[model samples]
Target: MADRDTVHYDGPAGGWGSLRGITRIFGKELPAPGVLDTLAHQNKPGGFMCTSCAWTKPAHHNPLEFCENGAKATLWELTTRRCTPDFFAGHTLCELKGWSDHDLEQQGRLTHPLRYDRETDRYLPCSWEEAFAAIGDNLKRLDPQSAVFYTSGRASLETAYLYQLFARLYGTNNLPDSSNMCHETTSISLKKVIGASVGTSVFEDFSACDAIFFFGQNTGSNSPRFLHPLQEAVKRGCRIVAFNPVVEKGLVAMINPQSPTEMLTGHETPISSHYLQVKAGGDIAAIMGLCKHVLDREDEARARGESVLDHDFIARHTHDFEAFTDKIRATSWEEIEDNSGLTRDALREAGEVYVEAERVIGIYGMGLTQQVHGFDNVAMLVNLLLMKGNIGRDGTGISPVRGHSNVQGQRTVGISEKPELVPMDKLARLFGFSPPMEKGLNTVETCEGVLAGTVKAFIGLGGNFLRAIPEQEAVAEAWQRLELTVQIATKLNRSHLVPGRAAYLLPCLGRSEEDRQAGGPQTVTMEDTFSCIHGSVGRRKPASEHLLSEPAIVAGIAKAVLAPNPKLRWDDWVGDYGKVRDLIEATYPQEFRGFNERLFTPGGFYRGNSARERIWKTASGKAEFTVPKELSATGFEDRPGRYRLITLRSNDQFNTTIYGYSDRLRGIEGTRDVLLINPDDMARAGLAEGQVVALASDADDGRERRVGGLKVLPFDLPDGCLGGYYPELNPLIPLSHHDVQSKTPAAKAVPVRILTGAAASG
Candidate 1:
């Protein structure tokens, strides 16, 4: 078959109107009667801001910054499909479960508010007040910890802030958010090395960098808008070094559908100067190899009496480098060479790029963060950057390309389980309520806590929390124990499966839709990947008029649970979101400076963080570094029937939403069950490509998940590791297997084996 690594696409690359033409042809497109004009792209002369990927290329920061995925997000958000109650009345919950993701969303927009009817197995129309009262009653019945306050990346800062506060007022600190699942390890490790979990560089820095190192991130499909800046870097002679098992089109060179120059010439931008296909879960080894190469180059340079690194930056800004150097020197070159899955030649070339270039920026994504040794993998990258004095400088820093618009911003605004002394101490001082000092549950911890029946409720700001987790069956069962589960969502997906004793589906306005309350139309705030927070106002009507804004719902529940809350003013802010903004400004002063007035500005001002630039807010006010003896190698168990399986989202999907029908890069369409495996391993097991296989997870109890009837595509994966799409294969992952420090499911480190068997069901 055509060389296995080759990417093929039959779909027409019809720039902008591809979706519009399809909408006219097909009946299933928008949630309302017609498509709304709600893309985050600022095409209008001076219209509203984009609510898609946080990256803003407005003429101010403009270098033409829309990624492919960002375009898809904009297109999807501004759809014309509607799922009226009449549509649901015509179908059953059972039918909807069997429907494809595109089919479910394509049915139309949710025209009216819907509530799950247990007796009838159908979603019936329910008023916003009725849904709110039902949710309030459920919150009144349980302890706060049982209910998890989950947030999706698809929310505004205003909604996310209000949701987190309401959960705190209800006495629960189980804020298991989207960040806990993807880049918490990046935040954790970056905090130690650079004093911040966020990538230290801004988009403008890419323009000035001489070299860019991409580790484990497939940006083209995952975050397409980044291509413009990357293309510019290439045009200016900045070499791009990409390291990952899969060679993505976006990372390589796919003609930018939006670029007039590339489109006119029908030519693609050359994405990478050197593409290193490292084995899966070999990031630490790869990073350590790069470091060793740099040291070797330094040694050679010392012969000529010239230093290969920035000694002054290291001497003044860092601590314990002598010990770090000792460890680096003692590390065996053999381990680095073998474990990294890259040749010395490749690493040497990478090191040359670092040494030759005066300034370098390392841009990475979740592939670097979701490993068994995720934290250490991140630390190793930090160590590489530190060796060259990359932080706190112009045109050189670590830029972690975050997923979901503003996912990182949500964590900054108090969605984290790891409480800093500043926010925790301030919360007790300002609100006059004793905050829970015990470290609460994270993503996997929340799930395990629920399985043990400690957590009683779950309130999601947005996203498919159930489908997003690993081991779908066990997570689904754990969710069944909750006293109440509420999803404040724009569209429904797999999360509703966790039917609590009382489940409330509150329909809310999306970023593309307008949010109106008693205080007139209100705009919400969101932060981009660069940690820039700004406001978002929907240009279209609500998907359903019966829907309420997330803030109003949060306030409603706060009023219900904190009936006797003396200091907490819930209704006051509900009447006017500006009051909510005022409270946010008063509480977290780092952001929201003159909250309302700032929105009137063009794209809003960047809330500068000194801490983000290596200014540690830790106890000693210096970043701390710790290495888990058992990291990245955590899932490298030599079990007989087990292999490390990393769960990933496909280019066709965003977070847990299946936006498109296929992953064209992987040669699969109309299916998510295809597993990426090494050809040698498949042959060793006597398995052929396109084989239907049964996977029995060795979770002590021998949990057998029959996800059979699947194709086995041989890929450039490490011999002992396999890769698959998440949420669907989540059932194979045990809820107990998680990172000790982060409480995140080792989604990048799950171990499972394949067998020929029957189709698996959830």
Candidate 2:
């Protein structure tokens, strides 16, 4: 690991750095010819989706719609490297667990179905029929509640819909997915206040908005494609404001790699007009401060016989406006400034810019959703937008930038643990079976169940559950107690190493690979961040002949588990995905009314958010304004030697899938074990640059959660805070440290302490 060399990159995002990233991936993963042709088809009509972020594409296609990370994801899938049974035979399960996450994936794509053999301590090849049969037999012997079906965001609408249907028919609502960990707060908070779970804004709103307020979203790394519209918006005089703990390079400025003028002239487009360095987990307080500034100015404007708040819009379309404003008035400037890490004057200046704009859009990411007060954070943001009549307008609304390509779509198709969120009546009528009405376990709850030895089986649709979750060591240990484990994936990951007694690794087709069934070559659909449903048809051949389509694999397992029923034709549905769409339309008629027709049309179609139409599904039948009871966004109190740890993804990573060790954006290369801290905090704690320190959780759970040998690197961050890569720092975040309502792990705000000397070894 090269820890001593720190290169401060000054160039804007998406310049030579992005180009080098693409070339490096191509050299390592896609050495085959015709790769460029396949990449050109990405995010275009009659082509596959980017298969990365949920960020949607425009109606008019750009020659290169994909970004560096997007290209890495695409080429990573199309790699010729194969992980055959022979490769598994060379290493034992116990030995593979010691490898780094990047090295494990670099072993290549899984080309065959594998079954773990305890006798040899290695994975052996197995037929699909044998694997499905064994899984069915194990599931039959256990209670439905003991089995957890976890889906990643990579699964398509057809696959997710079928997966949910299979789980419901199996008599359990234990369908925990990747959404539970990342954006569950968005669904929970937005649904309660705005009557819809998804964002109300469309992609085109970026062009029409007068101002865009960014809250805790790192656009350069997580969703680089978004930088284009933001750059265009800046050129057209749209005021962009950002509130985040780290001063992200992407938000500062960007150079479009595709723009020849920028590349030739080295011109960097400034993104955020104002960047506020708010404390980690202090979003609620900061937003409240903005609200207070606006309300105070509203009072001055009223005295001068001029209005700031939209009284007509609030009275006609919203409820509880007075109570919400009263709470804002009660909050003192001292409390706001202390908690938010921003001065009152700074907030007022940003608020003034916001008030000057005729229309605005609020865009956020996991930063606002992965905290203890994540639900309140989202609610307060909505309150600010509702105060200005930002919702349900042409150039205004909220946009929760999702990480996975199909995570939102999975929730839309009933992959939720909460039964009430789905239309149980419609499902029962269509499927001819009584669906489980009880609430099931979420990601955190599922971890608890596994640790307690209650969850007997785990079936993953795509993601690496063990690597992506919190309490890594504890969860991995508990996973060994499972009776059966099944992973349907295209490539090898860490989750496959910690297999259950009767574990099976089933290789599936990638999004870039064609899926040919009995009916014909079929295309799957995914709902983007903006709620637009688009079709994705793969153009490349399968990586291996043995690889099965996700829908086919799901149906195969479902048929083997359930008794032959006349109502559900598992074979026919898998044979023809159109039948799956027919059922999906029948289940959610309002959202997918003309599913097939609209899916094939140009640019697809929007599912339409009721909140966007001012049709509040809340009990009050109007948009709501919620008041904060406290100023602190994180519930934890300040203490000596305690620092709030913020978990982040590097530029070379997407979720738990790490592409490389180098974080080009932050200028950290060849190591993910470094901790970023402020220079003042480092001096106060008696720590030196490149010092290896241990981070131990400060939770009162009586458990010792520590990560050792993290080199300390001085950074520009808020006081009393540290930034570290996720999964490596995930152990420091307890499962109990989550939003009470949304149950999303507070990965963004973990309380911890640094230890030196002999303690660093543990």
Candidate 3:
């Protein structure tokens, strides 16, 4: 193992440091001609939407609206280097499997369709027709229920719609997506409370909000574009509160690159007027505490002949208020303080901020979603917002910050394992086929099916499925059992390296590359976190002429796999993507009406939200409040040497893709094999700074899951809570330890035992 470098990163979130990182990637990758121009086009009208975070673009465009990571995503896709046939011929699959994920992708983009040759242990070039035929044959051999179709968030709305449509038409509803792993809890909880599965507020609400509550989301590294709005909100005296285990630099202070004065003078805009370091798996308790204080204040106000609770709105548009308050009042402050790892004064302060604000926006991410009680965490936040009648109001609503650019859009276009969510009747009417009604597999269920030898074939649109899934070794073993695996991607990842009995890599056009079909240059649409649907058209030439658009690839497979159906025009749809949009509009008339024409409009259009209109689509015809059964914090009380582990992404990385080994914002450099633990926990565990340790799962499932050679770094974290970089620490998470409702892996809160000295070196 190599020695890791650790340094203190004292600079503000986005300054010269961020600019340097963006230029460094571009300098090394050396993208194609006119590739740099794509930056100017990003987030602008009639230009390509960023493939980075799902932060909504402002109604008015700026000259340089793109952020640092956005630039990295564009340049990463537009790299000049190509993985041609010659490159594959020189390196066998076994040889390539030894390379690090970063090094493998750094070799450059895949330029052709390649099939794995088991005899030679090599991936050789193959024609697109042959590849598609092989996939068709595999599908025909297996039962429709035995195949899982996975969609990545990077896929365009058209591609995802067609992908799910093909799966359902072929008599299967097994449409799993990236959402199953990340924000499924948000969808499940919000749908139960607000009758909708998405955020209720739009980008414009940011300016009107009096207070913004950020939970478990690192706006700086994960979604830097959000910092701009937050900066403006702070300037206008808007109170910003952050709740997380780690105090992120972006949430602490941010330096806007677009502001010349701040950039020149090193003046940083402070974010998060109040920062609360909630322990892992303690969000539910913390939120309940806030609600408890709010309800108490409301009672006091009522006694004084003043109304603090939105009585008029609650009486008109809500349900189960008394039951919800009963639960909140029953929660003791002792439990809240013990579980939340904070004082009652802190909870009271947060509640005071919430009470004083006229309008508030609650924003959260995976930090609250990747836990056993993830749904409850989200529901508690909703419960607090409901007390003030925050929903269906300007600048006051719930916002679940999505990680992917089009993740929400993919769900909107029917990329779900649940068949009921898909409009089968609409599809049958439009395309004249009996769509599958049987429920399919989610990400977790798909992995279980693979392990059980039930799911024989897997087709991935664009993602590192094996690495992103929990129980890395078990997932790898399941992959080896599959009959066939197909990867449609732009660059090489670990999933491509682990071939099944037969695997094929089909390279596709990236987001930054032009997708010119028979109809000429085309544009694709994406729905941001705010439900704003907009068009994204690429100006840069394709990295390789051989690369096909994702939609085209899905169409080819569909044409080959499904039996002849007169209503389905796979070829025609591939020739012109607008036809796909037209069909989408026809299928989802309520949301996508005039979708094609709206793409030409400035800033695109908003997908009208029913919850925002106060039209409750719930069982009671009103917004319902849910009460959590238990508000206790999670801890390893039975196990002596155990701590709660929270997996995190590095500043330079997105999800499982590592841009670099260093997490510059956290003062780490040159390596990712370090763990961030509370200094007090380190002392209790008899560990010192820079001491190497091995983390073993305390899941007690009789499976030995451990990651060795992790250096310990003491930092300011809640006691008994440890933090480590993801994909590396993913092995510690068990597939069985997931949320009961959402089925999302509990990556945020894993019980683990730290081993030092000889055990660590092993």
Whole-model Cα lDDT of every candidate shown, in order: 0.68, 0.89, 0.87
Q: TM-score of model 2 relative to the true fold?
A: 0.98
Off by over 4 Å in 3: 1-8, 633-638
Model 2: per-residue lDDT, tens digit, 1-762? 112233345668998789998898888885345568778988887788888998886687678989988999988888888899999889998888889888888878899999999899898999999999999999999999999999999999999999999999999999999999999999999999999998999988988999999999999998999999999999999999999998787898899999899989999999999999999988898999899989988999999999999899999989999899889888899989999999999899899888898899999988899988898999999998998899999999999999989999999999999999888898899878999988888999899999999999999999999988888899999899899999999888999998897999999999988899999899999999999999998878888899999999999999889988898998899899989999999999999998987775556689989999989999799998998766766769989988999998999988888899878888878899999988889999999999999999998788999998899998777899899999888888888999878889988889999999988784
Runs in model 1 lying further than 4 Å from the true structure:
1-37, 40-52, 57-67, 421-432, 564-569, 600-603, 611-614, 618-634, 638-642, 698-701, 757-762
List model 1 lDDT by residue over 673-706, tens digit each. Answer: 7777777778787777777676657555556664
- Candidate No. with top TM-score: 2
Q: Of the pair 1 and 2, which is ahead by lDDT?
A: 2
Candidate 1, residue 362: Cα displacement in angstroms equals 1.5
Q: Estimate each model's TM-score.
A: 0.91, 0.98, 0.98
Clash count per candidate: 39, 0, 0
Error of 3 at 302 (Å): 2.0
